[model samples]
Target: MIDWLDFVVLSLLALGVIFTVIRFVLGPKLSDRVVALDTFNMIIIGLIVFLALVFDSKLYLDIAIVYAVLAFLETIVFARYLEGKNNDNS
Candidate 1:
């Protein structure tokens, strides 16, 4: 049987992803959108970790670690691109 706590946790995570997506879409500036994207990635990582806990599996944990590294790299690359863009505009 499914537990009520599971529903609550999942609902909250879903809400987080939703809100971040909205921010990314509606943000006035590129930086705000990037930050929203980063937040969305973090929330996905949280969901993966939650899955690891729910399934009692280490594989999900490893996936989460790899995802985190990639997400960090992605954010860094985007930041560099934005930096270069801003420099060109100035």
Candidate 2:
């Protein structure tokens, strides 16, 4: 049976997606868009974990872990590139 917590988590995920979309659409800077994308990725990881717990799926949890690692790597690479660009400009 689906619980209130599941519904709440799903709702939050939906809200996060909506906000991410807004950021992507209206963001004035590359960094702002990157931050929004990072948030979206993290939210997806959280949602996956939540669903895994709800459905008792170890496979989903494993996939979530993999996704988290990839997201972290992406963030690090973006940060490094942005920082290098700033350094070059200065």
Which structure among the candidates has the greatest TM-score? 1
The CA lDDT of each predicted structure is 0.96, 0.90
Tens digits of per-residue lDDT for model 1 on 1-90?
Answer: 478888899999999999999999999999999999999999999999999988889999999999999999999999999999999999
Clashes, model 2: 0
Lowest lDDT 10-residue stretch of candidate 1 = 1-10
Supply the global lDDT for candidate 1: 0.96
TM-score, per-candidate, Cα-based: 0.93, 0.84
lDDT at 14 for candidate 2? 97
Query: 90 in model 1: Cα distance from truth in Å?
Result: 1.7
